[model samples]
Target: MFAKLPFRTGTTSSAIWQGFAGSVMLLLGSLGVGWLASSSVLIRTPLFILARTTPAAVICATVLLCLGALLMFRAWLRLSQHLSGWNDDAGPVLRKALILWVAPMMLTLPLFSRDAYAYIGQGRLMQQDLDPYTNGISALNNYFLLGPDTLWTEAPTPYGPLWLWLEHLAVLIPANSPEIALIPFRLASLAGVVLLAIYVPKLAARHGFNPHRALWLAVLNPVTLMNFIASVHNDSLMMGLVVAGLYYASTKRAVVGILFVTASIAIKPITLIALPFVGLLWAGSRAGWVRKFALWAATLGISMAVMGAMGAVNGLGFGWLAALQTPGTIWHWYAPVGIGSVSLGSLVDWLGGDGTPIADGIQKVAQVISILIVMALAFVKIRLGPSGGLGADLPEPQRYSHAVMRRMAWAFTAVVLLAPMIQPWYVVWLLAFFATTGIKDGWPLRTVFYLSAFFILIALTDQLSVFPWISMEVVRSIAVVVAVMGLLYLTLWDKKTSELFKRNKPDQHAFAVKS
Candidate 1:
């Protein structure tokens, strides 16, 4: 029913009509709430000055969120169909239209993203020459930004170089209203989005893989577009660099690959540890080690110089270096720690000991465990023979050059699983890899379905944070269940798992036959 929707790109008029109609409904719903919320409160109040959030509006907004999700599901069904070669003719136009339709999402900051305010405050701190790591926004001491609502005013951004630079731009933009301040910041992410839309598919195609599938993962995935762009997170910029780096590796541009990967590292260093292993595999014994070494050093030197220039201009003066440490800090909704805390906290508190010890212990343990595991995986990936499987059969080079590609998939999967502070959009980086994995096999329908479903559920939790009226536990519990299932699948059901252990694995022939 969903797939047969009138939104198919071949039906050019209908697709545009559907997009316009849907976007209009969403905007009207948003405006209704805005009117009501703004009606009661001071227009300039920092904490959610919803001018029109009457009781009816709240119910209506929640319903709209759910409905918008359903619409997104319908869109995904069609996208998956095109990806599986069911309607191979639909790829180009569908991907192009998707890029256009979703562009506005990146332009606007949605309600759930009070996180953007915290980002602005942190950027203000950078501009004022304060360290965001320790002082948070409080150090800025700007009453208008600090606001009456305490939590958001002082909450620090636990983001990496990619995001801090983005936030720095937002603070620099001259604007009287906070909402106006968000516009330029939102525009900044568009470059990453455009690069992703262009490169991921082209690179996949170069390897004889289904560029369409990779395109969907990077471009059309809902959680990715919403959480990163609308929510204004900088993971897109970091991940875009990774994709560019991967594309370079696929094309055998090892030197360029290392440079792009280093820039990605400069954004979020933890995500790029796997890049060195990829370089090692590509450059084995006969390859030019000296040139590669020089390339890496040059890349790091260039990125650091750029960072230094930006920092100095913002009056940051290398202070952002210290801010990178906070990226390792765990958020309450993050994995491993949040997985145990959300799931076990209730049980522990019920058991009379209070869950403080378990919660505190997991936070400390997660950081150590995550880094250790990533290092171990990098070691295994580097020692591989030309075409030998590291843990799974790599894609045929002539068929698609998925050799290094496969290792990258496993590496990305590992980081997503182990990272102490993973938000839903984090999964977007891996989703692109997973899509290529599917194409390497055959028709990976089941794997595609599960991932799409998991994406919807995780996106729901992030969107759910907005409505203060909803029972927070209700949403958190849903997140716990969804995240746990995803974690279990990545760990236990990977290609490395034997048939017995992973009874419900995706199609075996999916990746088995390439061309």
Candidate 2:
């Protein structure tokens, strides 16, 4: 089915052109969003003139931003196709595309979430010798100047101690200068992107898959670029380290893998679930099942000890564990648990009973069920035996690595699905790992592609701070029309229709070659 795509014949040069165009559009979109949502400190003086705060101006900026995001998604698809089978070295082409894709984001303010600013404020708290886990960013005094959302000002950080330890570097920058401090975190996120770029293909190569395609699916993905680089989220860091650790463990360096994955857990605890999969990769099929399970258990124990010691060293201890429920407070329809909670809560209220407790109980139960499902998948993967590559007769090591990758992918997917709260960026953790497992031209691929486009559009539209000048109904109508038209062109009319109209030429050598 993938063989019929028109972009399958596209060249690297054409793909790069599309990438450049996408970046330009993304820049325009980002600028629009900045004008509408960012504090004046984050916006350049000229941008204010270009993107006035009035309703019409905000609407126009929204259109421009949406158009840019859509164009970038289109270019990314073309680039992925170009990288898949084209024999010419993709390194230079990919690097150029990466630069175009990521450079504009560095200059943009945080887009989807105020988490980065929260990171800054938390760092300030730590710098003042206050325990960030016990106290909120407001403890820093005059922290509102940093533009952190009021929501998190009094809310304790939900991030792990290591993340806080690393974020403390922001305190070295002058006080009350949010924009300047923002640069360091953005750079750190960019570094994570670089790590993914460096390691994704290497991991793919070890398993006999096309490295370029893996890079395209994992690093060049629109969802990844938007959340990891554009919004400058720390998930990028955790994900990169997780992938690199998995690669090392698959290649027979279990210690190195353990270290990398441990760091990833410290960034955010979700990747901690990946340790068992790494152990499976390390043990391979030659080891007894008991030994494999033991290795997995050992890895987890060591990882926990390392993480605990690090937490102690920072003096933050395990306070983040208590704050794990923080995300549940920010409920939205996008989160599965949130949707259930809202619906159940509403129903209970209609039944003349207290609703909040019942809804919270339902959410907790759903989360626990998701965790159990993940554990079940992990055990099943271990017992399923070798599962990567094509056919029977592949090396045991490669096969084992492939199986581990699939299991790790499933574990991350479970985390995203079951978490009390989820955001579009959470998709990145699953997508990055799944990409390395060699998924090409299947339902899984299609799912990621469509989900990426849908969620990114949703995130862009929802994150905008609406103005009173234009009725939201008008904005919604216009956005819907533009989105439908853009999606139709990109997915159906642009190339699919052209292919349908072109006449099929007869095969010149089919009959003669038979003789």
Candidate 3:
């Protein structure tokens, strides 16, 4: 257990015991999700000993969650008040372990327990040449014969072309048991992990942050591993592709970025948000108009072709053209934007979450707003290329320039915010891009990252039981939301961001530099 713990020092017995305790928590949090997924007496016995009712589960969840929140808050205050300094090395390390520790709590993802099975049942439909997008579980597969779980029997498929195609493909793996269904999907989620490992450090090193810190932040995020690996969400793969695209874009490989982001959009169209940043990169180039135009056009064309082929092969075709029609069909919190604005809009009626005339209208309005905002930023960047040569957020003195790396971080953030839904795994975008940013900017980046991870695990604690209460889930969700936002401010949005846009005018630069 201590082996996994990065910090520990003691003589003899105390050190040994502490190490053992740490190991146990880590293992239990990661693999112990079996409590909800499996009904084996072995798994249930201990939890039963701990507490049986929904209240007990809720209580346990509440206590740990609150404690975790306070711990994180303490860390934040320490950093913000200048009582302590993280430096480059220590800042990211603390964030890594905290984030990774959150993974096990996601075991509840399965134990909360409905979505994965619906994916199975839906995949079974695709096996029979049925369109899952338009159909429910009953269309291709019968419900009464399974383990009596609603996720398996009833939840509708809500994912898009790439996920549905993969879900359909996963069905062919020949499952002898329910766990086998989880096998391929879990393995598939590893694509994000691999990508994080391969690119985060490289991207970080390129941008002047410690590559090691960046690598740990992305590759080792618990929510990412838990949701994608244990929970089997596809966001990991989508995020991996998105970040890979960003990594390529940073290298001036706009074509590669386009192809990768296109592939991501096929998985989830929200990845398309990165296009503006990609466009920004194109505009940043010294290339002539024809060359820049050709690069942009070629990438867009190739991306569209890939999406079309993907849809065609999966029997989805251009059905996604109807995406605008089903505006409210997805969950709001499936992305960071959703989480950020959870309280801004009407409390979405879950049943009415399906697109209807009113919700559709509102969603369209919101979508348009997001577009206007993104497009406006990109448009401003175009002028920079033509007239200013370069904008700020450039490391030295720009008013607001993201550079290649900061651009990646901000681009990924926008991608998640504008996503159709917000899921826990969606944090991978943050995890991925955090690695690719410049120096820490005196923000407690690691501490915030750790805080977010703790709340995620606390949320998962409820999944340890059969009927985890909505009240507790709600409480946990709120705590997580607070933790996430607090962290966001500390880590990503702490400083004066306008500097990212352009260099201060010379007159102002003189004052600002000295100020």
Candidate 4:
């Protein structure tokens, strides 16, 4: 039945170019609708002026951006179908696709986020020798006029010392111009993208998964390109280093791997989750509890030493620990914590009482539950053997590696889902780890594909800086309609893509290919 359907018969190069063209469209559209600051030099550019002045231009750009996003999504879906057939050329094919798709994004202004502007402000704070972990960007002159969200004005930076240092350097290079500072920030993110390109496939290969499929899901997905490249989030570098570290650790280079993971923690403390698994990898699969405990302590000590050194360089001294709770302040309607708190808070409000405390209590409870789940996943043993021992079907090392990667993936998944604010990019953290274990071509793969599409749509609609003269409702409605139609076409109208949703047998060819 599957063979009877007309799958899109084209070279991977075709899909590559299709996505590249879409990125070009996205770049052009971003000029008008991206998160541009009021003081942006682009505001004086003719394209910006034209898009802002004419309602038709704004609508058209919005449509183009939506269309471009859908086109890229479709191209990604098409490329996924060919994963089984890819051989040694998979690396080159994916690299080509990445380069082409990222080119336009590099040229465009920041899309779907103004966080880059915040990085500039934070960097400016560092430039003046101010402690970014303690002083919000609001301390700078004209900070409010910058493109960052006002929420950050009084919020100390949540980023770690290495990232703050990089931010300082990025701003220094541009002579404190926020607009020009974007270049260095984007480049820093691009470097992370490069790290991902290099390491994700290698890790997949080490885990006995299809490197081609893993690369497709982890590196070329719309989520990675849009957030890591377009929005320039520091999480890109963080995830990249984590992937690289895990890869090295799995291959018996524990010290090198720990250093890489430490660097990742310096970028964002979230990857600290990867350290315990690193200790497991270091202790070897057959080690006793004593060895495991020692390795775990060693791993923690190594990470702390690296972190302490980073802190000493700037005298930042762990102030970021206090600011780590800052992201929890945002409440997204889609998050589990957010939903639970809001629902409970509304019930309390209906009873004629203050609900803020109830909401806070709910968040705290959810956080505790998530932490418990993570701990269970980390420590619990999987009894794969008939007599309650490790499975004998696979080698001990293979079993151990698989167990560690699975736990790491689910641990991160638990954190992201239960967090107070679930950003679209946060999903990238788990996706990278999951790819190493392999996304089987069934509901698991389909779920990831659809989720990526959903997040892309959310990102596209969520950040449009609507012109005051135009009706925000009208513009948003158009974007939603266009984006939904495109998604429907991919889901039902396109013959090749529609086939993706079908419950077909797994492709053996995918795993048969040597990494």
**Number of the top-ranking candidate, with lDDT as the measure:** 4
Name the lDDT of candidate 3: 0.51
Which residues of candidate 3, in runs, are more than 4 Å off? Answer: 1-114, 144-162, 279-284, 288-290, 321-327, 330-362, 382-421, 439-458, 461-465, 468-515
Candidate 2 per-residue lDDT, tens place, 169-256, comes to 8868765456677777788799889999989888766665656677777898877988887777998888888888998899899989
TM for candidate 2 is 0.87
Cα lDDT tens digits, model 1, 249-363, are: 6566765766676666656665556465545444543346575465445555655675566556655455545655554444545466567754575678888877767766765
CA lDDT, candidate 1, residue 83: 41
Question: Relative to the unseen true structure, what is the C-alpha lDDT of residue 55 in candidate 1, on a scale of 0 to 100?
Answer: 47
Q: Rank the candidates by lDDT, best first.
A: 4, 2, 1, 3
Candidate 1: misplaced stretches above 4 Å?
A: 1-26, 32-51, 82-89, 104-108, 142-156, 159-166, 281-321, 325-334, 341-358, 381-401, 436-445, 461-515
Query: Per-residue alpha-carbon lDDT of model 4 for 377-443, expressed as tens digits?
Result: 7666543344333333446676677678888899899888888899988998888888887777778
Q: Would you list the C-alpha lDDT of every candidate in the order shown?
A: 0.54, 0.72, 0.51, 0.82
Indicate whether candidate 1 or candidate 4 has the larger TM-score.
4
Candidate rank order under TM-score: 4, 2, 1, 3
Q: Write out the backbone clash pairs for model 2.
A: 29-65
Residue 495 of model 3, lDDT score: 61
Candidate 4: list runs displaced more than 4 Å. 1-10, 175-177, 382-395, 509-515
Clashing pairs in 4: none
lDDT of 3 at 392: 34
